[model samples]
Target: MSAESRPAIDGRIAELDDGQRRLLFDRRVGDAGEVADATRALLALVRSEGDDALFDFARRFDGVELDALEVPREKWGEALESLDSEVIDALTRAARNIETFHRAQLPSDVEVEVEPGVTLGRVFVPLEAVGVYAPGGRAAYPSSVLMGVVPARAAGVKEIVVCSPPGPDGMPSPVVLAAAAIGGATRLFAVGGAGAIGALAFGTGSIPRCAAVVGPGNRWVLEAKQQVAGEVIIDSPAGPSEVLVVAEEGCAQPAWLAAELIAQAEHDPDAAVAFVTTSPSLLEAVRRELRIGVAATPRREVVAEALSTRGALLLAADHDEMMTFAEAYAGEHVVLCTRDPRADRAGMRTPGTVFLGGASSVAFGDYMTGANHVLPTAGTARSFSGLSALDFLRSYTWQELTAEGAAGMAGPVATLAEAEGLPGHATAARLRGSKAGEETS
Candidate 1:
C-alpha cells in the first residue's frame, strides 16, 4: 500500500459484456458485516437510552464526554466572534451564493384545467424541521454546513438543526459553528456517528425529531440512515465521493485531468474515479501525471488508496463509446473534457453534476461555484438528483370538479371502474350523475 506501488487499471469497453461493464462501473458503497453490526448496536442504544446513550457513545466512540448534549446559543455567537475574519467572509460569500442558487430552484405552484369545470394543481410546503450532519472524523466540512442548511433555510424550513462530532477538546469545530450560523441553523448538537443519526430519526430527550436528515458521512452514518428511513426521510445514500471524466485527447491537458481525478480521490479511500477516452496516448499521459501528482498531494496516502482500489481508465472505440460508457457509469461528478463540450453534454443522461471543461474544475463546484456539493453517489444519480431547495419542500396536490364535470365523464369512469372489478367505485362515480343508470335501484 505504498503510493508508488499502487495499481491503475486499463481496459477496453467493447471487450466487456453488459454485466462486466456494470461491475466495472458500479459505485455502490459495499457493506461490511462488522460495520453493519456495529451500526445496528449504536442505533439500538440511541433508540433505547436516548440522551444517556448519546453521552455513552460519545465517550466510547468519539472519546469525548458530554457536559451537555446540545451546544448553547451563546456558543454560536462566540464561534462567530472567535473565527478568523477571512474565513467568515468566505463562508458569508459562499452562503450568499448558495442561497441565490437554491432560491432559483424553488418549485413554482402548478394549476391546470384538465376538462371543462375540472381543475387540478400542486402546492409546495416546507418541512417543519431538518437535521444537517457535518462530518468531523477525518476533516471539518464547514462547506457541508453551507450546502445542507442553506437550502433548508431557502425553502423556509421552520427549524434547522446541526450535528457534528466533538473534537478532542469536547466541542464541535468553531469553524463549523460559524458556517452553521451563516447558513441559518436554529440549533447545534455536539453529537456524531450512528448515534447522532438515530437521535435525529427517533427523538432523544434533548434532540428533537426531524422530518428529514440531509448530509454526507462515512459507512456507519449511511447505514444508520437506511435503517431508519421509514421513521424519517433521508436525502440520499451519499456515502463517498466519485468522479468520471470523458475526454478527447487533443482537447484536454493530461495534467489537469489527472489533478481532477486525484482531487476527488483524496476525499476518501473508497472514492471512485475513472476516465474514458478514444486516445490511448492520452490515457497513458494522464496515468503518468497521476503518479507525479500523488507524490505532491497532501493526502497522498488517501488518494493512493482510492485510485488503486476503485480507479480505472477505459479505452472506448470512439467519442460515442466514451459518452456511452460515462452515461452508464452514472458518476457523482462527470467532467466533459471535449472540444465540443456543449454538444457532448446534451448526450450525457446520468450524473449528479456535470462540469464542462478542463477550466471548470470539480473543486469549484464543491465550494464556491454556488452549485451543491451534496451529490448523489454510488450510481444513485440515475434515479436521485443532487440535493436542492426542492428536497426540503413537499408538494401536495389537489383536484376540484363541478357536478357537470363529474357527470360528463360518469359513463367512462364507471365503465373503467367496473372493468377493474371495483363496482363500488363505479357506483360512487355514477351517483354524481343525473343521467339514466345513475340510480342504484
Candidate 2:
C-alpha cells in the first residue's frame, strides 16, 4: 500500500516532525470559546428555568417534544420485558460481574494513632445521589448503564439516577432501560446532552439534582460538565475515545491488531488510535491489515476519518523507547501485545487501563471485563483515573487531640498562624494552650 493512501501517518517516534508530534500529543478535546459560552448559557438557563429549559432544549437539539422528562418507574420493568431474553441475560450477567468487582473496591474505614493522645481517622461516605449519563447519540450503550450504575449501587448510593437521550419514540433505548433495571438504578430520565447534565447538576422540577455525575458523552456533555464543576462533582473531562497498542515483533497478529484499532476508531470521528512497534515489518503488515479492516467495517466513514486525521503508526527505536512513548502518551486504553506483557506492564504507570497480550482486546474491557470503561481521555490519564466505586464515595478525616496533645501542638500552630498574619487563629491557638495549662495546674 502506498504511504499517501494509508489512513494513518507512518513515522519514527523519534523523527516525528512538528505536525506529527502535535497530532499525537496535542489531541486535546476541542472545546472552542463559542462552545464554552453556549454551554454556560445552557447551564444558566437550566438553573433558572428548570424543566422549561430542558423541554426547550429537547425540541431544539433532540428534535423531540416531550411532555415529561422522567420515565415512568414502571417503564423500566416493561423495557426489560420487551428485550430479547439473550440481551436480558447478558445484561444480568454483566451487572453481576460489575457489582462484584465494585464491591471489592469498597474501601474500609481507617483509624490511626500517629502520636501520643492524637487519634486521626477517615470514613467513607456514599453520596446520597448520583447521575449516570449513558450516551444514546451514535449508539445505545446499555453497557455504559451497567458501568455507571452498578458501581454506584455497589458503593451503597441510595439514588442512582440514570439519564439517557430519548429516541424518536420519546424514550431512552429499551436496552438502556433494561440495563438500568438490572443495575438497580433508583430513577431513570429520558433527557440528554448538555440539558441533561444541567438538569442533573442544578435540579429541575422533574429531575432531582445529583451530588456527582459519572459517565461519558460527546464534547457538549464534557463542556457542560466543566461549566458545572463547581455546582456538582464530575468524574473527569472526557474527550474522544483513544487507544494505543504496543506490540513486540512476533507477539501480535496483524489482523487482531487492526481489529483493535478499528474498534476504537469507530467510536467517533475524533477518536484516536496508534500502533507502536520496534519492528518495521510488523508495522507495515498492520498498516495493510488496517486498510483491509477499514474497508469492510459498517462505520467505515467514521473509522476512516478518525484514522486519517488522528491515527499514527509509530516505529520505536527499541523496547525502552516503545515503553517510554506509551507511558508519555498515557492512552485511555493501552494494550500490551508483547512477548512478556507482565514484565512490560511494570514499566507502565499512566494508562487508564491496560490489556495484557494480544488476546486481551479492549472490546472486552469496554463491555464485560468487570472494569469500568468511563476512563480519562486525551492525556488526562496522566492525572485522572478510570471511574470506580470510589467516585461515588467521599472521605473525610477526623482528628481528636487530648489536652496534652493540644498543648503540644498549640505553640507551633500559633507560630505558623502568626507568621501567616492570621491573628485570630494565633489567638485561638494561644487560648487553647493557656486553657490546657490551667487545667493541668
Candidate 3:
C-alpha cells in the first residue's frame, strides 16, 4: 500500500462525527466476545483445579509439561549465576534505578487531629504478598519483571511471587529469573496466561495467593484480572502498548517521528500509534518516511497492520484543537514534540506519562529511565495510573476517640442516623454517649 492510501483517516478536527469520535475514544478492542469466553473458561479451570489445572494449561497452551508449579528458591541463585556478566550488570543497574525512583513514591504514615480529642489518619501498610506476571510466550520480558517487582519491593511487600510461562524445558527464562532476583522477588513460578492470574487470585497448591497482581499482559491475562478483580487488587487494565505524538511544524524530524510511531506499532498488530499536528506537510513527510521505515523494519508486517488499523496521523486546526483531540483520545503514552513542549503543557489533560520535546522517546521511558513502563492502555489512562510502589499497598484509616470526642459525635451521629431511618444506628450512638456519661460520673 502507498503511504497516502494507508488506512489512516486524514481530516480536519471539526469533521469528526459521533461514530468517529467513539472510534477514537473507545477502548473496546474490536469485540471482547471471544477473549472473554476463553478467559472465563481458563479462569474457571484454574480456580477449580488449582495446580492440576496449571499443569494442564501449561501443557495445552504453553506446550510445556511441568513436574512442579514453582521454581525453587535455590534455582533463583543458579539462574542469577548462569546469566551473562553484562546482562547481569545491566539488570543490576536498571534495578537500582527502578528502586531509587519508586522509593520516593512510598507514602509517609499519616496522622491528623481533626478535632479536639479526635485523631483520624491513614496508615499505609504493604501487602503481605503480590504476584507479578511477565509475559513470555512470544518474547522474554526482563523489563516487565523489574517494573512489577521493584515497585512492590520498594513498597515493603513481604513476599513478591513472579509467574511467567515456562519454556520447552519447563523453566522460566533465565533472564527473567535474573531480573526477578535483582528486583527482590521472593518466589518464582512457571505459570502464565489467564491460569497464572487465576492462580495468583486464588491460591494453588504451590503458588501462594497474592493480595494484589501488578504487571502488563495480553488480552487474556488482562481479562482474567478483570474477572477476579474482587478477589484481589489489580494495577490497571494494561492490555497493549500505545503511543501518541503531538508534533508541530518544525518540532521533529520526519524520519525520527516515523521511527517513534513505528517502534510503538512493532509492539503488536492491535497496538495503537497516532500522531496529531497542524501541519499537513509534516504528516505527508512522515507518511513518506514510514513507507521506507516499515519496509526496512524486521516487524514490518506488524507495524503496517497496526498503522492501518488503530494508527492515525490527524490534522488539527491549531495547537488548542490538537490538545482537545488528544484529550479525547487519551492515549497510553503521550509525546510532545514541539519547539517548547512545556509551553504547550498549560491545559493538556494527560492520560499517561508525557514525553517532552523531540528528543524524548517512549523507548527511554520503557527501559532504564527509572519510570514504570506498565501504564494503562485503551483510554483507561483517563482514569487509571501506571503501576508504581503505591499499587502494592493498602491504606488503613484509623480513628481514636476520647470520651469527650465520643460524646461530641454522638448527638450528630444519632440525629443523622435517625434522619436516615436507621434507628439501630441511632441507638448504638446513644449507647456510646450513655457509656461515656457513666464513665465521667
Q: Give me the candidate number with maximum TM-score.
A: 2
Pairs of colliding residues, candidate 3: none
- What Cα-based lDDT does every candidate model obtain? 0.87, 0.89, 0.86
Steric collisions counted per model: 0, 0, 0
Instruction: Sort the candidates on lDDT, descending order.
Output: 2, 1, 3
Which is the better candidate, 1 or 3, if ranked by TM-score? 3
Question: Each prediction's TM-score against the native?
Answer: 0.92, 0.94, 0.93
What is the C-alpha lDDT profile of model 1 across 151-207, one tens digit per residue? 999999999999999999788899998888899999999999899999998989999
Candidate ranking (TM-score, best to worst): 2, 3, 1
Error of 1 at 140 (Å): 0.7
How well is each residue in 1-441 modelled by candidate 2, as lDDT tens digits?
543226567889889888777778878755567788988899889999999998898889888999888999789889988999999988888888888888998999999988887799999999999999999878899999999999999999999999999998899999999999999999999899998999999888988889999889888888888888898989987768999999988897999998999999999988989999999999999989988888889998888888888899889999999999998888999999998999988888899999999899999989888998999988888899999999999999999887777777889999999999999999887777787564863
Segments of candidate 3 deviating more than 4 angstroms: 1-7, 16-20, 431-441
Taking the tens digit of each residue's C-alpha lDDT, what string does model 3 give over 207-247?
99999987888888889999899999999999978888899
